[model samples]
Target: MSFSSFDRKKENSPQPSQWKLLRQELLKYLECFLMAVINGCQVSAPPNRTAAMWEDFITCLKHQDLVSSAALETQSCYLLTKTAVSRPLFLILDDNFYYQSMRYEVYQLARKYSLGFCQLFLDCSLETCLQRNGQRPQALPAETIHLMEGKIEKPNPEKNAWEHNSLIIPSTTCSSEASLKLTDLLLTALENPVTYIEDNVEQKKADRIICSTNVLHQADQMLRRIVSQTMKEAKDEQVLPFNLKLLAEELNKLKAEFLEDLKHGNKKYLCSQETVHIPDIISFFHYEKDNIVRKYFSKPH
Candidate 1:
C-alpha cells in the first residue's frame, strides 16, 4: 500500500515533532492492516484512540481518488479481501522520506514483523522535482520543495547496514535494467529479512553494551565520506582501474575491522566516558587507508 505525502493536507502546518507522531500513527495502522491480512481477516479497523486520524487518512486517500467512495460507508476502516487466502503479500511504501530517521522507522517496523525491507531512492535533482511539482493540479509551494531538498538524505549503504538492501536510481535512468535490478532487490529482501533474536528482560539489560552503536553509526557515516573523498582523489591522480578496485577492497576491509573493534568495546579507542573517541578512530582509519594506498601505488601500475 502507498501513501503519498502530497495527498495528505492539513489546514495548519504540523511541526516536526507533530509530523513524526502522525507518521508513527499511520505506520501503526499499516502494521495493524498487515496483521489482519496475514491472519486472513476480512476487515481491519483502527483502534478507538486513533480512529479520527485513520478517518482523516482515509479521507485524504478518497480525495486523491486512490480509494473507492464505498469505503466511507464501511464500518470496518478498511476491507482487505472478501475471503482471505493464505498467500504472501508484497507491500510497497511510496513516499518522499527526506530524513534517514524517517526511513529507519519503517525499517524497524519491517524488522518487528520479520518482513522484507528494501527502499528505492529516487535521485532526482531539485530543479526537476520542482518542475514536476509545478505541473501537478494541486501543486505544493516551491519553497516546500526547496526545504525538502535541503533536508533530504539519500541512502548510503556504506554508512548504514540496514540500508544495504536499498538502490539509488537516478530520476532519468528508469530503464529495463533498473526495473530488473529493483525486482532482484525485492526478491533478495523477501528471501532474507532482517534477522535478530528477540530480547528478553535479562537480555535487555545487556542492550546497554550496544548503546554506543548510535555513536558508531555517526562515525560510520563520517568515515564513509572520508573514504569516498580519498577514492575520488586517487581517481583524479590517474590511479589504474585495477589498483582502484584493490584500493576499495582494502578500505572496506579496514572499515569492517574497525567497526568490529568498536562493537567489541576496544578500550584503546574509547574515552573516559566509555564513548567512542571518534577523532582518534578517524585518525587511525586515515593512517591505515593512506598506508594501503601507498602500497597499491608503490609499484608500477
Candidate 2:
C-alpha cells in the first residue's frame, strides 16, 4: 500500500490511551536505539566472552569497506521491516556508523520507512574517555582513541541537517538520568518529527544570538584593554594636560566608532532576525562602558 493510504488508515484507526500505549510500546523497542559505543570509550563491556568476541569481530569488520557496506544494507533492511510492522523505534548504531557518513543514509532510510530518527552523542572529554578505555578488560590502544577522536564528527542540530534531533549527553550525567533524558527526548522527537525543520531554524536563530553576544563582549574587552594601555603609556611618558575629561572624551569617541563598525559589519545577521533585541545589546554595552569609565577614569592620575 502507498504511504499516504497507510497514513490515512492509521489516522482513522481507534487508539485508546495513545500516550500510555505509545510509552509501553516504546519501552519494548528501546533496544533498537540503544546503540553500542565501539570507539574504545565504553565504560563497561559485556562479561560474556562470546558477546565480547562478537562485538570485537563486528568492530573489526566495520573497518573493511566491502564488509561494512554489506552489513549496513542488511541492517537497514531488517530495521525498515521491523519499523513497518510496529511503531517507529530508535535505531542505535555504533559511533563508527556516523564516522563513515552512513548515518546520513540511515537517516534517509528512516524517513523513507516513516521512522523517527534522533542521535544521542555521549560526550566525554578525551582524558575521561581514555581513562574509561583503560578500565576495560581488553583495553584498546591509546592510539585507537586518538584516531577515533580525529575521525568522529560530533552531531550538531544547528549545523547538520540530518541531525535535527541530535543531543549531547555530558560525561558527568548518571546512567539512569541519561536514560530518562534520552527517552524523553526520543519521545518528543517521535511525536513531533515534522517540526524538525522549524526546530532547526530556531536553533540557528539562537546560535546567531549567542555569536552576536560573544562578539559584543569581545569588543567591550578590546575597548577596555586599549583604553587602559593608552592611559598607562601616557602616564609613563608624563604627557601634559592628560586628565579624566580628556580620557573620557577619547574613549567615548572610540566606543562610538566601534559601535558603528559593529552595526555596519553585522548588519545582515543583526537586522535579518527580530528575535534578539538590538537595543538591549546596545544598553548592555552602554552600561559596561559607564562602569569601566567610573571604575578607571575616576581615579586621580
Off by over 4 Å in 1: 10-13, 42-44, 56-79, 82-86, 198-271, 275-301
lDDT of candidate 1 over 1-301, digit per residue (tens): 4566532665666776587677887887677666766665533555453665777766654554433455535665454443223344566777888877778778878877788899898899989999999999879899989999998988877766677899888988969999999899989988988765544643343344335646677678888988898788788888989989988899888888888878777654344545556787887788778788887565322
lDDT, model 2, position 98? 32
Worst 10 residues of 2 by lDDT: 1-10
State how far residue 189 of model 2 sits from its true place (Å): 3.0
Q: Write the per-residue lDDT of candidate 2 for residues 18-49, one digit (tens) a residue.
A: 53343333222222322221121212222332
List TM-score per model, in order. Answer: 0.59, 0.36
On the 0 to 100 scale, the lDDT of residue 212 in model 2 is 58
User: What TM-score should be assigned to candidate 1?
Assistant: 0.59
lDDT of the candidates, in the order given: 0.72, 0.51
Lowest summed lDDT window (length 10), candidate 1: 201-210
